[model samples]
Target: MKKSVFILLLFVAGSLMAQETRLLRQPTLSGNKVAFTYGADVWVTNLENNITTRLTSTGAVESNPVFSPDGKTIAFTSNRSGTNAVYTVPVEGGTPTRLTWYPAGATVCGWTPDGEQVLFASPRETAPSGFKRLWTVSKNGGPEILLTKQWGNNGSFSPDGKKIAIDRVSRWDVEWRAYRGGQNTPLVILNLADMSEELIPNEKTTDINPVWLGEKVYFLTDRDWTMNIWSYNTATKELKQETKYKGADVKWLAGNKNQLVFEREGFLLTLDIASGKTTQLSISITGDFPWAEVQWTDVSQRASSVSLSATGKRAIMEARGEIFTVPVENGNTRNLTNTSGVADRSPIWSPKGDKVAWFSDAGGKSYSLMIGAQDGLTPPKSISIGE
Candidate 1:
């Protein structure tokens, strides 16, 4: 009986440790595989078996992973070299090859319909530096060719590669939900042959992340006051709403020929083109998070609200939500409020130089005045300041 109970407890502990990770972003879909950005690295998961593998583990941020046309390679942007640039790695994982060398950073959008080149946006040659234009570089590495003279930040190619659907303006803050300002622009379908432009119907709402699927251009719009999937049929000139997500704005919409994948509230969801059905993809990530570990940090450079003692023997300051004092000519720096989880601010030295005072939220209900010994030898006395 004792052995059985012990085994049951072990099983329960294992189950609790297997909870799925949320907050995944920038999801791209192609066939049965999906790639996204998590923990500042790029990760790929196979939908068939639900096996997730970390592709890039660099210290720099890697984001916006777009699959190749054949789904065997992923193109993403990384700031590993001190500036954002384009890179491509095999879908199964391998050494990434840098493709862009311009000073201005490039953001990976998607692949050309033919899979011969990787599409990206950059303001390299633009005059004002605020306008970004779409450019493409060959997968084998060569000069990047400008797709169009018109300004474009993110775009997708048509099935035949003759035309492209692009968002002309990039918002300064994409997370500003329901933003209906002048920056809000309609998706532009630009004809490569004549440079003619066709604007999708709009009423000053934010429309972005255009993905071309079949004869329709699918995008995310805030026309209904929440960003959701909407589509426009190029053949019939008809518009339709694809998904009615009211909770969190759908972001980073990407697609293949038959399916679409996006992020909503930090979870990845997919929509089938034929059935119009949306399903959340279950993904679990297990690894050691070294950044989340507890470690001592030097707060000297972050010190604020400094005050000198009455006789100038010591100085008190607040840093990293803690109260600290440093000797003027000798002794070590003393941390008065060592509480790491509580916020302590506005520290000052007492007029008599016998004590230190600060306002802290240690009570968890309101800010309170905390008085402690000058040498941190005694616990602090808290007097609540009601909200």
Candidate 2:
């Protein structure tokens, strides 16, 4: 086991230095509890004492896990039924309930802020126009509601749930093909009450992932045709570009309207709307790709990188010969361990942002869970999987 762990950690360190980091999606943090994908499984960790629990099984490729508003349940899509369909499970692990019984496969984007429904983009009917509707489903796991009659995806709900902001695929000059990235999609905001749709700045630019931050709705746009990140204000009706750097895949972590935790250029960064300043999140060379993304095979050589817990305070990560940390805001980072043979992988922050749980091969053949402190840096206690 010790020998295997050494090899695993060594591999992750090598990968970081080996490739030009392929950016994936960021985990959505709800308070101190966040969901993470590991080898087709979604696991939740409590940061208080490093208690890790598996929230998903039948894992046949589960990703994009989002927590309900009450944090008691998780909403995500799984290919367990041979196609992508929405599934819900208890935050801790239990039987999953299928939300979308559509005969067609589907993928979800965002959830309503109230946790009452989920918003997604998928083919609504038989293939004729390839019409993908902006759809939402009740958390009670019933039939879904087709909110918009257009073919689009990447949905976001305003904080109050009165409005839905999404990317619109307006012009389709070609035949409909599902699951493939379509064309002519731009940033679109839909008023649910009135069904009035409004288009934002650029039509050709890919304006996706619209997040409602209080008075303004912020989204990632390549308005300059650079695939860079941008933001929009709903209250002032002012449009703004937040970054000069080419950051395409970005996520809003947790903060007020002005402050945001996001990822850009393969680095997790924080931006302040009031100050117009950005700060690099204190993380190691963690890759953005999560376990649920690709097949369990292609990324196997890929090791776990860095992850933020619900609190977003301290970061727990595995790399090379060290599991390290610095103060998230003020303190400097300190290396917790430097064992060469123990290849630690996948650090998840607990809901309280107090403890961290990770998988390491220090024992042998199979990877197991290791729980430790958010800052104290003691050796991790192995979590029993009952295998």
Candidate 3:
């Protein structure tokens, strides 16, 4: 009976680990499928069948996946070749084809309406200021063509492919909540034919991730001190807020004429353009993470605090949130506090060399003073440090 219960517990634990996952980001939608970046790889899920497939598994930071017009191909940015560049892979999973070779790196934004070229942002031509400009390269492979001289970090072409709704500046600190400073800029509707520009209405608020769908230009903004989805109707000359999320800001907005996909609070969600309804996707990812495997790490060079014994025979040090001691000339290095889950810091040897003192959060609360023998053979006495 005991052996059967142990085996049943293992099965229960494995089942819980295979449930829905969070932290999904950079979602792009087309038809009944959506693609996003998770665990540094691209994954696609079909809304109808509820099936998810991993597209790229190179273990190289791949992100910003944009689906093509027909939903057959996906363009994304990857640093697999030592630089962030554009790459394309099929929706069903296959070999990724390199698209750009710029040394300055390129980030995939979106594709043109015709689906013949892939659009990206790069700082290749801008040397002194290093501001990015819009560029596009043929999906079949060729030299990238400069789309415009104006700065553009993220954008999407209109349905006609004649105009683009673009964000002119990319913020240095994107996650600084409720920030209103000089870095904030409005989105621009640039006419590719005459190079004329029309700025979206703004009052020094952050507006980014422009996606053009039909007569409206949809984007994410922090105008209300919380990032939410907003739209600018060109025909009616009106601006309206679509989503009223209060906690976390919406990120990585991308879409087509049918619907829009974005990330909010680590979940992938979609908004119907016609109906204005939103739905969160439930996706579960199961795979082997080689980097997360348990292994020994050397933290000697990461020592943050150190103190020498009074006799100069040993030294106590704090490194990687743990306490350690090393002999000056004779003995091997010893880890005095091996509590990996707790943070032990500011270690110092006692003046008489019989004890070690440090601050630790071993009680799972606030830090407190910990005093123990130098050999770590006895239990450390923890003294409370009140709030």
Candidate 4:
């Protein structure tokens, strides 16, 4: 009996350890290593040895790590100096050297093909805040050069350095799957010598991350439902799907030479350019996830979309993507949507003061109208809203 109980406990512990962990974003690849952002901090991992290293350990968020062409340094964005600014540090890990000092922030997009300068996107001259333009600054820190006069962001220079494949508009919600909103637009490859343009034939789909690799432009598109790797041959004007991912979308992709690496569903995958073969790298990142620590958090400032109950004695609120109900004078505070990977939004209290309604993706591909009791006792009713 004692042995059976011990084995049962061991099985439970193994199950808990096997739970999936996510939110790994903005991955960039070099010749032998891959760098990505996890828990708002930059991390690097070797593709061959599976050795992982932490690049930054600051209170402020640091993200969007891009490797220099030589693979000696990494450029990333950090709010360590107050506002978001471009910064670079040694790939082995050390103090970062600030590159841009303008009042408006810049994000590292990619390095110049010649490796002379670091390319970035900023909105310093743009009147509006959302619109961004591509710019480049010397790695040694100097004046910024305007790469594009029009509104554009997330661009990569061609191999010849005379042209670029860029995305004109940025999406508001990148994780909202199959989004065909007004912000969606096709990518454009602009020739700098003649100021000429060529469209990539996007009818009404979201296309982004226009990477110019040799004579082909590799990008991410949700035209076939789930986001997958796609390539457009400049010479033949042919578009083809590179990967057929059915479950999770490919999060971030970066490539150099004949190899490409990307992150998908918290796992790292590498694609061989010549052979068209993809291999999932077995990388084990072991470090202190400081942000994942359990502690009391003040959700007051994070609250949004609050609606009062019928009698005004209670209120339903959405805070940090979780739906909750709090009392004014009596009753206990309850978290309605406790599932971590799911998204519950626009929570509103019912007029009758008995139920709450909200729109939730629930980590699925579609959104649903979720209705449940205000007190958290009953299972929520989910009605499909749309795809």
lDDT (C-alpha, whole model) for all candidates: 0.87, 0.62, 0.87, 0.83
**Cα distance off (Å), candidate 1, residue 63:** 1.0
**Model 4 error, position 247 (Å):** 3.8
Residue range 223-332, candidate 4, lDDT tens digits: 89988999999999999999998978888878888988888887777899999999876655566655555445556667779787998877778876688777766666
For candidate 3, the per-residue lDDT at 77 reads 98
Candidate 4 CA-lDDT value? 0.83
Q: List the residue pairs that clash in candidate 1.
A: none
lDDT of 1 by residue, 1-387 (tens): 111100000000111135568879999988899999988899999999999999998889999999999999999999999999999999999999999999999999989998999999998888855689999999988999999988898999999999999999888997898887899888999999999999999999999999998999999998999899999999999999999878778877999889999998788999998999999999987765566555566556778898889988778888878777877766677778777568899988778999888999885778999888999988989887765
Of candidate 1, the 10-residue stretch with the lowest lDDT total is 4-13
lDDT of 1 at 182: 90
Q: Against the true structure, what is each candidate's TM-score?
A: 0.76, 0.58, 0.77, 0.73
List where candidate 4 sits over 4 angstroms from the true fold.
Answer: 1-21, 128-130, 294-387
Which residue runs does candidate 2 get wrong by more than 4 Å? 1-24, 38-40, 45-54, 57-59, 170-182, 246-259, 265-387
Cα-lDDT of candidate 2: 0.62
Question: Using TM-score as the measure, what is the rank order of every candidate, best first?
Answer: 3, 1, 4, 2
lDDT at residue 259 of model 3 (Cα atoms): 90
* Backbone clashes in model 4, listed as residue pairs: none
Which of the two candidates, 1 or 4, achieves a greater TM-score against the reference? 1
